[model samples]
Target chain A: MSTVTLHKVCKTFGEGKLAVHALRDIDLEVGNGDFVCLSGPSGSGKTTLLNMIGGLDRPTSGEITVANQRVDQMDKGELAEIRLRNIGFVFQAYNLIPVLSARENVEFVMQLQGIPPEIRHQKSKEILAEVGLNGMEDRKPAELSGGQQQRVAVARALVSEPALILADEPTANLDSVTAEKLVELLRHLNDEHGITFVISTHDKMVMGHARRLLKMHDGKIIDDIQQR
Target chain B: MGIVFHLAWRNLWRNRRRTWLTAGAIAFSTILLVLWVPIQFGAYEIMINASLAVFPGHAQIQRPGYQEKPKIRNAIDNAETLAKKLRASNQFVGVATRAQGFALLSSGTRSYGAQVVGVEPVFESGTSSIPGLVKKGRYLSGIDAQEMVIGAALARNLKIKIGDEVTLIGGGKDGSVAAAILPVVGIFESGSNELDRFFSEIPLHTFQNIFSMGHSAHAIAIVGKTVEEQDSLLTALRQETKDRNDIVILGWEQLVPGLKEGIQVDKVSGFIFYGILIAVVVFSILNTFLMSVLERTREFGLMLALGSRPKRIAMLMMLESTLLTLMGLIIGMTIGSALVYWVHIVGFAYPGMEDLAQQYNMPGLSRLYPQLDLFNFLIGPGSIFIATNIVAWIPVLRIRKLEPVEAMRTI
Candidate 1:
């Protein structure tokens, strides 16, 4: 069964004499546990597509659905609900709330999901250890390295057990070794937990790790290939 | 709710310096109230006490219209019976009967207009403070003895020393001749310029005989144990005198409307000042929270994108502001209470106030001790609580309208 479906999706920014087409006629489908990478250069609409798929931004015209729910037509609040319960996002910058400790950052989504403290605490520690950052629950984002902060972000996303994780350049700021380690961790999550991931990145390493690869240019997907 | 609380509380400390500074400003306003309210109350209380002490007591009984028109003709004919009734009531310390009339005093070489008051010398100690105001010589010794207590300023104007005979000539109650030649036994300075210059006290029997008032008196001034007892005493006096159309009784408040008016004006001004003070403090809180909301735009957007509702995000900010306000209120009240209690114990005095206070009838230096209780606590800090809750919404509303996508792009 597909975790997300996109058909004839198009996005436009600005208007009149100053309009830019950010996405064009995007058609895509991702089954459960599918690890896909949207690879393209900057302004090639990969991040925009990822944002629309995550319900972080709505397409100007299209039918986009995730986890059996229509996302393109959802209001801001409904989109927020969709993102909270069904979709998880990993941004390029690893935007962890600076004031929160590692355990707090990991349990942030679960807290909003109304999980009790004891259960949320236990579940977050479990996820943090799985992300290879055990015994670092009390460390704040500022105290963590780039790779560790990204792992905390990943822990936060997976801790909620969402159906799909949309990452926009999740390894963009990390070294090659860190990037490899991160890809391996994400691959392990997909294999072990049956969670689907759709990542938008320019990194060749992410493309090399993707189960399926789609290449895009000028807002349209021009290549789709099975990687393994 | 616990998660929201945690988020809000931690967020406040994210800028610990700024939060403490904002809370401090709020606490500062509360302390201002804590200090100001008590001082005003203390000063007013002392002034009333001293002024009431300079005679007329806190309540009085007199012939009808005597308060409106002062003369020997308005004297209470049944004053002896009324004094008996008042004393029997035991609601007062004592009731001193008097028949006062306007007259002129001449000491051969000097003559001056004066307000001659008739008094019973032995009873004056318990009812009036005039006997205690003596600055020179002695108070009147007997009702039948031909002697008087005159004000120091009046003595100065007459150039008369103690033992000098002064003649008082005035119209009789029956339109007959009224005159007396009495030796000055004492000269008192009552602090009030008018009292010191124009007042003279002789025995009530002598005054009635000279003024031809028979056994009647102009007024019976009643003294209660405390000034606050006047209300109940007035009520009792009214109830006792209900059948008598020939007399009227008044409490201190009725007798001195000026004092009441002055206190009322001070209260209104105090409320205006307190309102402005708390308002500025609350807006300072509002400013802090607003800046926090603006600064954390990206984080807020991330939270919203992570599925926190827009209202939920706003609620979180409100929660943060509420925590900040509570902290300020607790800290400020604690500090204010400590300071107010110290002032209450040690008393507060200002230089030059002794001279100023001496100018009035109050007998000592002006050292004020403001009273504090639950009323002050409720009015001062409670106002802050309501103000803070209402003001906190400004920032929450601002955050409510924020777009997640736009906010994420803020920084």
Candidate 2:
């Protein structure tokens, strides 16, 4: 079954005089547990496409269905509910709320989902250890290294057991070795835990890890390929 | 609801410096307002009660228009009957009659214009503060044929003391001018310099004879059972005197409009201060909260995108502001109330200004015990609560207009 689908979608910003078309006529689909990479250079609508697919932005014209629900027409609260329940996000900046500790950051989405404290803690610690940062769980984002923080962000994404994980340039700010290690961790979660990954990136190193790759340029998908 | 309040409280500590500063500002303003209002209101209280003690005795009964003109013509001849009726009503502690006239009091080479009040000596002593404030000589006895009570300042002006006979010359009945000699009986000092300088008291019969009114008193003075009973007593007197269309019953507020007007001025000024205080505190709180909201722009977006409702975010911001303000209010009220209670106990004194107070005939600089009405405290802190709540919306409205994409990039 498809976990994400976008049909003839467009994203226009501003109104009338200042409007810019950020994404135009985008059609895509990703099945459950299928790891897909959306690779593009700057201004190629990679992040905008990812945002629409994740239900964080509404398409200017067309429909987006995620996890069998018409997410394009969902209200802000409904979109938030979808994001909280089905979608997990990993960003280039590793946007952890600086006030929360590592373990707390992993537990935050579950807490919002009304998961009990013990269950949240147990699952968060389990995921933190899987990401190879178990003992550093109490440290805040500022107290950890860039790679460690990104790992914590990845841990937070998977801790909620979301079906589709949207990673926007998740390795853009890290060194090649750390970036490779982070991608391996995401691939490990994808392969072992059956989590689907839709990664948006310009890095060849990131795209090389994708099982399916779609290339984009100037707001249009240029090439699609599948690997064994 | 409990989560909201708990998170709000925790958020206050997240910006400890800002929270503490806002609270300190609110608390200090509350303290100032609490302290200033009572002292201001207490001034009016002291003026009214002190004046009524010596002159009006809370209320008065007289021939209609007698208070306005107070001429010798509008005399209440049935003063005894009126006094009896007033006593029977059980509203008055004492009912006394007083006949007043403009007279020239002369002793040797000195002469001064004086208001000679003809009071029933025995009853007037208990009704008025004159006997209690005597500085020299014995108070006049009801049976003393030629006894008088002169204010110390008036006595000094005439340079006469007890046992000295001062001749009073005034217009008598039918416009005839008459002269009578009355012995100076005692010197009284009633704190108010204006009163001590111009007023004199004499036996009721002596004043009637001196003014040639022949046993008639110009008005009756009624004292209430207590300060709280003054209004009811005045109302009852007005009701009973309504039949005697020639008579008017006046509460001290109406009888002494100037003094009452002065007291009202104090009350109005107190509210103005409170208004100014609320404005200043409100502005400070708004400025602080706006800065905080501006700084938290991206974080708010993240929360909203993560699944918090727009209204819930607003509610959260409002909750935070209210929590901060309440903490401030509790601390402010504690400090402010303590200061108010201290002033009530020890009072604020304006030292070396006694002469100025005496010259203006205002309540002198003793310990100025300030008394506040019940609503003053409630309104004081309640205004801050309202102010912070209203101000919190400015940030909430700003956030509401933000698109999630734009809000996410605010950092």
Please tell me which predicted candidate would have the highest TM-score against the true structure: 1
Query: lDDT tens digits, residues B63-130, model 1?
Result: 76778778678778868678878788787787888889888899988999999988878877666677
- The residue-level lDDT of candidate 2 at A13 comes to 84
- Per-prediction DockQ scores? 0.69, 0.42
**Fnat for each model:** 0.80, 0.41
Second chain TM-score, each model: 0.89, 0.87
Candidate 2, residues B5-120, lDDT tens digits: the string is 54567667777898899889888877776666666667666666667777777788887788888788789886767777877877668888888888899999999998988888
lDDT of each: 0.86, 0.80
Error of 1 at B187 (Å): 2.7
Weakest 10 consecutive residues of candidate 1 chain B by summed lDDT: B356-365
* Candidate 1 CAPRI-style tier: medium
Question: What's model 1's lDDT at A115?
Answer: 92
